[model samples]
Target: MKLPCLSIIVLAHLLLGPLSVNALGATLDSSVTSLHHGSCDINNGETNCTNIIPSPAKLHSGHSSHGMPILNMTDLEPQQRLFWEQYDTTTYWSIANDHKVMLYLHTFSLIISVMALYPISIMLSITKSPFYIPVLTTHLIVMLFSLLAFFIYEPSTPAYLYPNNAYTKMSIILFFVTIVHYVAAIVKSLSEWVIAAGTHDIVFDDDNSDTIHSISSAHDDLDIDNLEPVTGQPFETKYQNQLMANIMANKWVNSTVCSFGYLSTLVFSLFNPLLFIYHVIFVFTGVAWSFRIGMGNQVFNVLAHFIKGGVFFLFGLLTWARFIGAWADKGWAWNLNPNDETQSDEEDIGNDYEGTKIKINKKLTMEFIECFLIFFYGSTNIFMEHMANTNGAWSVKDLQHASIAFMFLGGGLAGLLCESQVVSRFLPNKKHAISFNPFGAFVIFWTGILMSQHEQEIPTSTIIHSQWGNLLATAAVFRLFTYTLLYLKPPTNAEPTRPFTEAIVSFCLIAGGLVFIQSNTETVLGMVYRGIDGMFTLNVTVGATALLMSWQFVVFAIKGWSERS
Candidate 1:
């Protein structure tokens, strides 16, 4: 199925037309001009901007049905001919000429991104290694940068002051984020390479035998029960070896999300209350069951909490039932049968192991189902959502923005909850009361207000572009900062109520949310709702944030591989 390079180039030229014409930019410009200068022909009722009537040998100056004269350039005066030619040229070249700068920058950036990716791809091919952090990281950076550069390099908006250019402006910001990701990836890769060469660790075989021993440490007299390292740090092996659990949990979460996404879209389109209620119940039960799939590392653990919060915030009051069910389950677990405690320790261990194994198989099945759903229902929803707007349905703008805010708010809440879990694990004897962290509270309050806003009419595209667009970028930046603090901070055993870093990060997040809320001055029924104009900002911001957080996996890989080396 693979074509030769020359054939590929030829095909691209044939299909996309040389990539030299700046096709997309030119078409957009042409469409804009067509709105004003376009004329409809009576013969076919077809509209054209620069349509010329065919002349029969001689210059024809006949009056058409609309009383407009159909004349050749030869029949018109020199001044008239000059005006027509000027109009035609402007109509045609404004699109091509205006986008020329952007086209060059866009093409050059593509080359750069592709070049950066080539090395990583080659490395992966040569090593055939399961550890693909470096490769994954390079691809992510290249993707982020390419998308960002495309958005930012618009030739039409040179001044960059247009409020309606929300998509373009947001792209510019995201492009910068890609650069930051690239730098971070480089630093991380080198650190892993260094750490790999410095560590003395053993590798265990499939039969649970420690075959490879560290030359520096004599283990004959060492206490095998002590898992602590010589440096007194908690063994990172606990987290590194939990990749299977992370992968499983990630699959379950993704599947659960895709399921709910499809279900929600279906209900929205059909206006089926029964189906919606069933979807809520399914997500609630699914979320509860999925929580058991994780192996308790912070990455998987945080992800578990995120599913809960995301479901809660996205679905709102519907998930209150799930919360009640979860609480009841917790109570039931606390009051487990006393007779079950009489079982042998071996039996309990065997049961727990078997249960986890079964769940893993089920998660794999769900993962496959999720993939199908993404390509089928996921794609359908995107197309339908666009069609809804194009067909002049009541604007779903407010709902869209609210949904995005709820997602972030949910993640913020999950972050706070994850911190509590971390604290509880480090200090097992102390009962840690959950803090009503400001960031989570602020997000919750705003999300509540947003959820209640009315979506009677579509807000102006201008409003969505100018105000909330900027806020989306700002929010993503702060969220990324929170992730940076969470991942890059030194891992320690300190048992404080909360770290000062967390407080500072919380303040910044709250400030960003406030700025977002306040950015839009318009109020409906005394409540302000921020609306998103173009899908560009939200899509890129979410993607970049997710990818940036994934950098932690690269860090983990470095530690694990270095320890083994």
Candidate 2:
């Protein structure tokens, strides 16, 4: 009796399953058709309705001009929704795995490069070992292998293709640049070694009678009897004597190879292994992930977010580096007066020897650079903003953004003029060391205010914009404070004057830049759909910024320690 009952039930299930599925699919199609009819407009004797029903095989294939799906399960009946949900889940996992693989490969290469280049080279330099050639050779080999791995293990997805892919282009450029850098460095180092070896046997007899007599005869014009008693020694004579002495003491210091080698070493010391690796990885991750956010029809927004944000992010990092004494040798560490008497003398000597007479006012400073970049960005962005409109007519959005660009242009120009000698000559109190130009900061403040109030269709996007905007505004305020403080109590020494407010400014710019990137419409929508909130993104951004800053600090500390040792 039990076996017959089981057989009957099994037979009934087999017979009804297909019929039930077909019935449910028909019901979904009917519901979708009704909804479409209800929602779409009806013209004279004609219907203009979009078909909301999706084919089973192409449930996720429908896309809008913006590259997002036009139809999702929200418009589908229950059974259809279930089918689409399952498909989405599977697709999501596959994509996640692909991303993981790409990231893992990049991480491996980055770690290997960092380990091979950073600490080992620093130690070798400190020990003054002759194994630098081998180390560089090893690095070259590692870079070659890494490039091969990047090519071979890359994902086969269409999104990761080489042609028209910015990430791929940047990666290739970086690889070539790295190769060139290392090759040049190796050649310079080898040249120095050869020169040292060749000159090792040469000796100079400084105390020779003829040499002493020539030196005394050369200094006869500087004798006390030849100078006016009140004036002591003429400034020109003293400067010439010092310049000649320096030239005699360091004959090869101005050699092209030696200068290039010194510059390369300085660059390597500042941009250590960890910082370089992180930057490369960041470029890969940021640009590659940008494709997933869908770049079609939103090129302007994407570029604005990534490029502007990236600049500020880098600016903040450099500011932090300056605070920590990275470029102090060049007098770029934010001192009120970076110029020293000795440094000025050296510059004059170099200028005199090179026979190039440049005016002091023509020299570029950090503030001048800041103004120049702002001006450049604005001038280019004005046209870019206009390009977003395809109808050859300016929209309100275009005009609005263009107005902001105009502000930047005007402010930057004003800043440039203010820092120039033409304007400084008119001021009641003129000083070369301190700059009081506030136009750059004012531009930032105004831009932030506008952005914070900028409206968006989605609340999440608006919140994100406001978040970054507030951060930018805060940074500007802090920067103003920094300027004021510096003006009040000018630094006497040319050291890293780590203003407390600068730390805040750095954090704000970094965090704001990151948040700005996240404010893309598609990105915000995706995060919202995935239940990711603003706080989560903020926390992640802050944490990553902290980690980056800490790594930079460590690199600077190590470099300082090595130099001291």
Candidate 3:
């Protein structure tokens, strides 16, 4: 089905490319020389200009997600023009076009992720189906990773500050990931079915019913006490059984789960090469979020992080500069409250700080906060996903819902197929069950979504008669509402965590070992065992004092010379 569909696509492109020259941006009427901004070289009025198509940024005018984009391919510097010309043509789109493509792609990926999968049936039925496991697992990992930036982390604390195409890009990646996973599952299952048809003797000792009956085959009338039978190899002779052993030995063990060369190729699909390629674009766009995914690129990673640090520092300086200007004009600091309205739409009420000489260094504060949010969004989501996939006892429906009494399922059936313990014993993927904690990962995604969707107190919204208090209050309310829902309700439809910061928090953390120790506390006579603190307040002295007394008692009373003897 896919092959035929793809064939049509290829045929259509080839047949249409030449006929749609104008549609393809090869407008010949405009003299190509006018395109390049460099000194237009005019020779006898025949201006020499490059006939290259303009980037969306160069062609487009007005407000874009990435500020006012300068649209015109010819306006690019000579080096940039050369760079783009050498770029691969297989898939080439400027920022605006890319965003459109992303919208389509992500929808598809999400659909793919929703379906339930049959790992056991797939492993048993497919012929040469080894490739599916690795492909599926890699697609799952990278798509999930990429989503961290677009929907969740970036939305909450934008590194580049929004209107950029990151969210759109993220949606597209996830959409494709879903499509790839679904298509791969179909292929894998069919292949497995083919393999199983030709292959024989996959069953183990349990397959031999003759042995199953023989142990119980003692005549029904035989007394239970006298029914003891020979337990060694059930075959009448060893010669017959050796043949069975040979068939079993030749069978593919690892291949039973995934096909050859699957894991290695799948690993490269998104982050490594895919995200690395984006570094070039990020450089031109001046964004930092892209750097988080491409950390494996050591040289680029360091360069990007440093560049981000400088951008943040410069922003801080600009904010300070604003304060200095205000102080010079009014002999005091600006205020948070808007000048004319009771409820200003600005995130920071510059008017509210009227009498104050200096601001709280919002530039530094926002920088630190944004940076922390980025690390936090990425790290915690990764951590939570790892935990769920590894430990949570996920069921098939948990793949789609919050079905369990306490825990919720994550990664859907895909997770179970790739990483669950029992399924992995029979149906393995790249990393096995070790790193897969689907519920935790889903929580990470959910958390990112909530944060990303919640708007922050940026200055621009306030510039146009917007109330600072209103903006702040709105953001705060939205934050509190979403967070409360996340905390109170378990992510029933694909498990999600309480929030990013819940784990580090402790209101009533009941340690598993702490309660057990309480029972033993009364057993000792002289030992002073201070009970666990009821509040978050410091019981530092009491805790230390109790521990010291316990240690003294143990050392003097429990460790005597007779013990060694």
**Best TM-score among the predictions, by candidate number:** 2
Displacement of residue 415 (Cα, Å) in model 2 is: 0.8
Residues forming the 10-long window of minimal summed lDDT in candidate 1: 521-530
Reference-based TM-score of each model: 0.25, 0.65, 0.20
User: Which 10 consecutive residues of model 2 have the lowest summed lDDT?
Assistant: 15-24
Q: lDDT for each of the candidates?
A: 0.31, 0.54, 0.28
Task: List where candidate 1 sits over 4 angstroms from the true fold.
Answer: 1-102, 111-170, 199-565
Scored by lDDT, the top model is 2
Supply the global lDDT for candidate 3.
0.28
lDDT of 1: 0.31
Ranking by TM-score: 2, 1, 3
Tell me the spans in candidate 3 whose CA falls farther than 4 Å from its real position: 1-38, 42-111, 114-209, 213-477, 480-565
Sort all candidates by lDDT, best to worst.
2, 1, 3
